[model samples]
Target: MRHIHDAPAGLIDFLFTELLLSLKDQGYSEFSLGSVPLAGLEARRGARFSARLGAYIYHHSTQFYNFEGLRSFKEKFDPEWRSVYVAVPPGANIVAVVADVVRLIGGGGRDRVGGKASR
Candidate 1:
């Protein structure tokens, strides 16, 4: 049962709150919404160049990526933030791969994730 005042929050936030509550009622000790794309990307000393770029994207790419907005939405659930690391093999073109991904997602291709190709 949800009360009107129980959610002064927005639609997405309200839905996630209810979903989490439902999971807790169903004996779920943990729930994961996976990693929010660019959360916790602050510029700090001794950080990787990729980390700095992520911080830039997170701060500046609002039109393309809703980094802080998603982060804020997830923060409503008080989730425990964790650092995730990725390793690349020697001499891999990580930058190019990421650029391709961004281009793909930003509708720069005839081959989007679930989009069909021209016949």
Candidate 2:
């Protein structure tokens, strides 16, 4: 059973709100929607050089990636955004590590877990 309101919140939104409320009641302080890589970068005064470059790429590279859509979906939950970065060890093969991670995440040409790609 659910209460009907003048403006009905969609099921996904309603469930998300309930989840957040439950987490709060259980004393959880934060909810994290993991990064949409290279999304939501913005240039601001005193921002780092890498961040400025990333922002430029995000704004300009829509054809190459779906940065806007990724950001929009995450924004629906009213979550705060923060920059995340990875550090590599000296002499490590970054490309290999990335490929391994992609494979592990089932992003390498197929979904290993469900056997279907998620839209």
Candidate 3:
């Protein structure tokens, strides 16, 4: 897998946008925008749609810097949390995965193992 660390911020933004667009194109009309602070609080306000059919599906993070806090927060929404995984090629450096996980968790350090600078 191509590391996000090597990509420019513009590209990363573009890719994220592309992913959203792709989800929309794939019939995900009522996509839930998540990961913002207090997402659970907002979700508890009530369904975006009527009771007959729920308006939006909550997409939540399985991993958080504060895992317990995040899990507790998301649980308030009664979301059906799912597991997601990345399929990498055989013999991929585990450190890359570790660095990626750290980065995702807001670890803002240069990727010395890959000789890449964090933006």
**Which candidate's TM-score is highest?**
1
How do the candidates rank by TM-score, highest first? 1, 2, 3
Query: What lDDT is reached at residue 61 by model 2?
Result: 63
What are the clashing pairs of model 2?
none
Order candidates by lDDT, high to low: 1, 2, 3
lDDT of each: 0.66, 0.62, 0.45
Better of 1 and 3 by lDDT: 1
Pitting candidate 2 against candidate 3, the one with the higher TM-score is 2
* Candidate 2 TM-score to native: 0.45
In model 1, which runs have C-alpha deviations exceeding 4 angstroms?
1-9, 44-46, 97-119
Model 1: how large is the Cα RMSD against the reference? 6.8
Model 1 residue 63 CA deviation in Å: 1.2
Per-candidate alpha-carbon RMSD to the true structure:
6.8, 8.2, 15.4
* Candidate 1: residue 90 Cα off by (Å): 4.4
- Stretches of model 2 off by over 4 angstroms after superposition: 1-9, 41-66, 88-119
- The predicted structure with the larger lDDT, 1 or 2, is 1
